[model samples]
Target: MATTTLGVKLDDPTRERLKAAAQSIDRTPHWLIKQAIFNYLEKLESGATLLELDGSAARDNEDRGELAEDAGLQCFLDFAESIQPQSVLRAAITSAYRRPEQEVVPMLLEQARLTAPVAEATNKMAAAIAEKLRNQKSAGGRAGIVQGLLQEFSLSSQEGVALMCLAEALLRIPDKGTRDALIRDKISNGNWQPHLGNSPSLFVNAATWGLLLTGKLVATHNEAGLTSSLSRIIGRSGEPMIRKGVDMAMRLMGEQFVTGETIGEALANASRFEAKGFRYSYDMLGEAALTEHDAQKYLASYEQAIHSIGKASHGRGIYEGPGISIKLSALHPRYSRAQYERVMEELYPRLLSLTLLAKQYDIGLNIDAEEADRLELSLDLLERLCFEPQLTGWNGIGFVIQAYQKRCPYVIDYVIDLARRSRHRLMIRLVKGAYWDSEIKRAQVEGLEGYPVYTRKVYTDVSYIACARKLLAAPEVIYPQFATHNAHTLAAIYQIAGQNYYPGQYEFQCLHGMGEPLYEQVVGKVADGKLNRPCRVYAPVGTHETLLAYLVRRLLENGANTSFVNRIADHSISIQELVADPVSQIERMATQEGGFGLPHPRIPLPRDLYGAERANSSGIDMANEHRLGSLSSALLATAHNDWKAAPMLGCPAGA
Candidate 1:
């Protein structure tokens, strides 16, 4: 075989051992190393379950840290220094993820192999419908997008996201006078905002005024005099009657949520999904807590949800966990970096309790990613819990990585390290991210630096693929779960992951109601009569009160012009563009600093909040922080407290 002579920096003992192993194998040292890599890959694929480590094994690994480092170097040499280019590494993923005729033909033939004509006919019909939708995508643009959003009744997700984006954009206007001046100018032209009277602009403006516009529409259409007669009632959804109206509309549209009055009802619905060859990670919906009371209420809800899921989950097996995704922000009002020490102290205890409960029940409790600012704090708590002795034996704890963030790859590295240290296998759900518009607008408004995310749709896609390649290769540490609807992206992942990766090693996730056809294709039986892949449906369980905002964000994602679901049917866009090889895409997008790596956010970040400190590497005991925090002791001691019948003496005096 053709190869490059890889130089190794080794001490005498290691060098002698390598020579001895080579002699024992009756092969050159390089040849033995190459064969060992092939064996490891074979070990992963041939197994029914993915690789995992135990605490004892991990401790042994730490003892042989030098050897593990050598193994890591060996992995790098094997994967990166291949005979040909490492195509998966430098690939710039195109936004459009298109499938080819040849790829479809094999699958069609596989479908024909099925015994049932009805099933074959159904598959053909689905394929035709999917193509028709793809051909129709590009023509829609802003007007098409607006109508799509409107058709969805402007609920919490993507359809409603334009409004959130608009609201965020308006926040960038620092001066109230300037904001009012712009509004007045738009009013003169019979529009709500500048250039917002028609087509796409109208859609964006409506989205910007999302809830606000919804209230107006309620008033205009209510004719019941319920809203028209009460102007404030129509405009402010937070008002009693108006909030009721919003809930009614949400239930009518289904709001892409699966909530019920009780956890049992929701789990029953989830069971139907499980029966249909899909797994679920249920999210109990609620906004970030505004007070300690709200936090306590949410904690109770979570504690109950865990108990319910654990009871329901049986007969399936280990890691077939009753997966529930949690938002830490909802667990505490003070979940911020400025309160890092206190937040960690406060949040860890609650999370630990849940983690222990999860351990008791064999359920997966994942910490979901939220806004960019809270990323550091979330990671700290997650890592702390991951390493906690209570969780060392369990494999179900998970964390989400948002590909939209520029530092997502870096985040993945940290997770892998955390898992390795703890000797735990982690489920990493890689998502394209939800709060794109918010992140962009926040950066702009803060006037700190450039955007925290990629400006182009392709950049995020590229970043996701890059991260996926890393995770999929590290099967021992991470169980990668990619949540995407883009067929092109899925196909690229399947292709690049190589023959060693089993469909079971990683999972594909789609929104509960969305991407049905795409996932059907993914997990569907092929020519060999074997299932293609297992998939997860991210199901949100919550009431109407928690539904609206989530719905708007989902709408924003779906309604965006760059979204694959939106543009898949657009005929003007070439299949090549949709499925361009990332490697070539990177070559085309090359710059002086290499391809697509942008400068860090120029605005200062709150470093204190970050779990991973940048400098001052060595931490002595928390002496300094303790001294600084001592000032708070007196304040707490002096705080108001009312109890014991308010020290009543009036009854005694009267007697």
Candidate 2:
């Protein structure tokens, strides 16, 4: 195992406390210290700070998401929003989102009571479908796989297995070529199998069939001899044919997504969105820059996109710039916490250049949210950009924050303060996060204290509302943009805004193609004629190849059995279960040890340390030369042999 050396300077009393805490947890002081260091380093590396990732009840757990997840999501939202809402469901979301500040504590415990069983059953059903695919593959051309599973699980299982299975299948195997082969087989050859039955998606079906047909099954059964021999014979000689099949499948799969590969195509699409009530944030999709050359190329593409959007949107609301979001990771290879100062120094010019371009075009430029670890540094860059003299006048500058994170509220608080002090109204777009599975897996691999996001979907929903409340309440310092496809969440926002709502006070956002039905209702184009809030559509503009990760994330997010979209789509699931109040869910969770995610943290919140300075996130700002220099001097003094015994954060052994 690889490891880094960590040094600590603790006073006798502090060491004693560490020892006691370790003892209480039945761990060695060394173990405790290392754990603390690991967390501390992760925070620093991920751009979290003492005030950002410090001790708090909500200090852990967060999540992130993608594009082209519309068709099924649109269908589900249309049903839920139009259906006579279960009164309980309405009351639950309304009460939760619209509740007063004092009416707090206990979240989702009741919802858990009501929906936990159904959710579990739904998961079991989905898992069984996946297993059936596995079994049918093992059985080699078993004709009854899909039909048999559906009969056993029943017909309503479509929602359980639907669009989610494609992602689940893709997620099962990490190898791109193997996955491609699997997908190809499902779409083309799987269609040929009558007994294999229909799969969730053509892609998913193709993946299932590919599993059975492509690889050699591990077992040697007499029942499989003829088929197995054919498989080996074909496998050895079918390389050229297999590649052609995979390529064809991928092409067909690309049809639903991949709006256009070029900016001109994206711009044409954006014009259509503008015709609707929806505002567009055009994203040119690609990964982080592996080389400085790639970073320059990306920066140029962003500038061009901004120019086009600015030209088109110039005459609109002065405050509303054409929305164009970019990823900082895509701008630099060293966009990590470990690189810290170097990233800040390098990013400053690039961001300043981009922000300048946006300002020039009067376009809203937001930093797209990436993995949780990248957040801290991203925020640092944004904070600095907000303060930069060149773009100080532009409030169109903003970034996304995933509410699924335990640290979201704090991050919001930080931004709100930064916005206040910086003399620019920072635009805050709150999302429910997208990268849950990967984030969780990464944490486990690293053996961190807990997941960085809410494990339960409802918990993330709760966090979304809480953060929304803060943003709505502070409209002067920040503009709140709530992005979701859930009808309940949409209703909550409506109630929270009350009768005094303005279209722009707080806006709603959904992925461009997703929630088409929901947006219509929100804009009051529906027959009932209740005009909802102003909504923005989060759309990605890129070719299919570059947009694959984004598309896959959308699938994983919405396809999971526990997913809100999937649950409501399951028609057999009652409204009562779908909209169970989170407050009650927490109450039910409290009955069990380690059940409710909320922590009665033993340590004080890090924000408390900064007292009044913590307000509006000014406490976390580091642009102050005096403060930075003092800290730098201290660290430099301790440069060798612990910086010549000069102080840095924690004090000397004796103080």
Using lDDT, give the best candidate's number: 1
Cα lDDT tens digits, model 2, 210-316, are 54454222122223556876667554655435445544443433333344577778667666656766677778888888999989988898888888778878657
Error of 2 at 75 (Å): 60
Q: Which regions of candidate 1 are displaced past 4 Å? A: 1-254, 257-261, 500-504, 527-531, 569-576, 580-655
Off by over 4 Å in 2: 1-224, 227-257, 318-321, 525-530, 592-595, 598-655
RMSD of each: 19.3, 19.0
What TM-score does prediction 2 earn? 0.62
The Cα local distance difference test for each model comes to 0.59, 0.59
TM-score of each: 0.58, 0.62
Give the top-scoring candidate (TM-score). Answer: 2
Which 10-residue window of candidate 1 scores lowest in summed lDDT?
89-98
